[model samples]
Target: MLETRSLTVRFGGQAAVDGVTCAFHRGTLTAIVGPNGAGKTTYFNLISGQLRATAGDVFLSGARITTLPASRRARRGLGRAFQLTNLFPDLSVLENVRLAVQAQAGIGLDFLGLAARHTALHDRAMAVLERVNLASRAAVPAAALSHGDQRKLEVAILLAMQPRIFMFDEPTAGMSVDEVPVILDLIEAIRQDRDRTILLVEHKMDVVRRLADRVIVLHQGRLAADGAPEDVVASAVVQEAYLGVRAGDV
Candidate 1:
């Protein structure tokens, strides 16, 4: 559903993402894995339009969107969540999600119709909160929630956008062991749909093995290995670049 053609991003003398080309098929979960400085996040930023490509193009569903801004890409069904929690710290949980729903519906700027639009937006937001298991805390301030709950709320905000393509950058980062499964399950639920395309960048090999239908390995800003999780993880090149070890040692 998403394709990048020779995408490159150069910062002064360094190329963070260098001519990397790949495709993410519909209804599949693909994991992008590599060691630090592998250009995984840079590639994501290029595709999501958070960072502009120095060269090459990004296409969503066959249409070129290399120059589209982040907001425009989001409007076209591209949704992203970062490694860190991002939300309104002071807003009630429900209000945070409600605002996302409102933005998706393009009613946030409709001051004249807000009263009529709010009721529908509230219901939609509540439904999304329920999906993320945060309905009970809908009235609580986002800052008051646990770290894991805050992460879940971020997912809820994405769900509120009703995206067709989900790009998650370490959705479970920094969570306690007990909280990991909850976030993982929520991501798995999104993957259950056969029409949505999901791209994930996760450091947890177990999570990648359990969740990804395919794996794309990056090393030094290039596509190193792209295949099944077992094959990619077992690759000598991947092991060497990612862990400085041979496959047998793994």
Candidate 2:
């Protein structure tokens, strides 16, 4: 559903992402994995428009969106969550999600309308919060929630937008052992929707092995390998690029 063609960027005469081309299809979750500084997040930024490409293009559903800003891209069905929570610190969790639902529905003026008049928005937001297990905390300010709950809230907001493609950068990072499964389970549920496309940039091999339909290994900002998870994860490219081990050593 999304394609990046020779997508690349540079800083100080170095290519962080170098001519990498890949297509992510509907109904499949592709995991991008590599060691630090391998340009995993940088690649995401390029696609999502946080970083402009020095060269190449990004396309969503066969339309070129290489030059669109992040917000515009988001409006066109690109949903992203980062390692750091992006939220209104002062808004109640319900308000945060309600706003997303409002934006998705293209209700520009009704944001200032009374909550009583926006019963549908309230209901939709509450339902998303419940999916992320944050319904009970709807009245709590997003800033007041625990780190794990904040992560859940972020996911809840992403769901409220109902984007066609979901991009998560390190969804489980910094989450507690007990909290990890909640996020993972939600991702699994999203994957079950055959019309949705999911892109996960994650470090944990176990998590990748468990959740990914396909795996793409990046090394020095290049597409080093791409294949089925079991095959790519077990290949020489992943062994050498990801674990820094040569095939003979294994």
Tens digits of lDDT, candidate 2, 64-87: 999999989989999988878889
> For each candidate, what TM-score against the reference?
0.94, 0.94
Indicate the worst ten consecutive residues by lDDT in candidate 1.
Answer: 241-250
- How much is the lDDT of residue 41 in candidate 1? 88
- Model 1 lDDT tens row, 1-250: 8999999999997999999999999999999998877899899999989899999999999999999999999999998887788899999999999988887887656657654456988999999999888999999999999998998898889889888899898888878898888778888888999889999998888999999999998898999999999999888877788756323334
Candidate 1 to truth, TM: 0.94
lDDT of each: 0.89, 0.92
- Residue 67, model 2: lDDT of 96
**Candidate 1: which stretches are off by over 4 Å?**
115-117, 245-250
- Evaluated against the true structure, the overall lDDT of model 1 is 0.89
Candidate 1 clashing pairs, residues 3+ apart or interchain: none
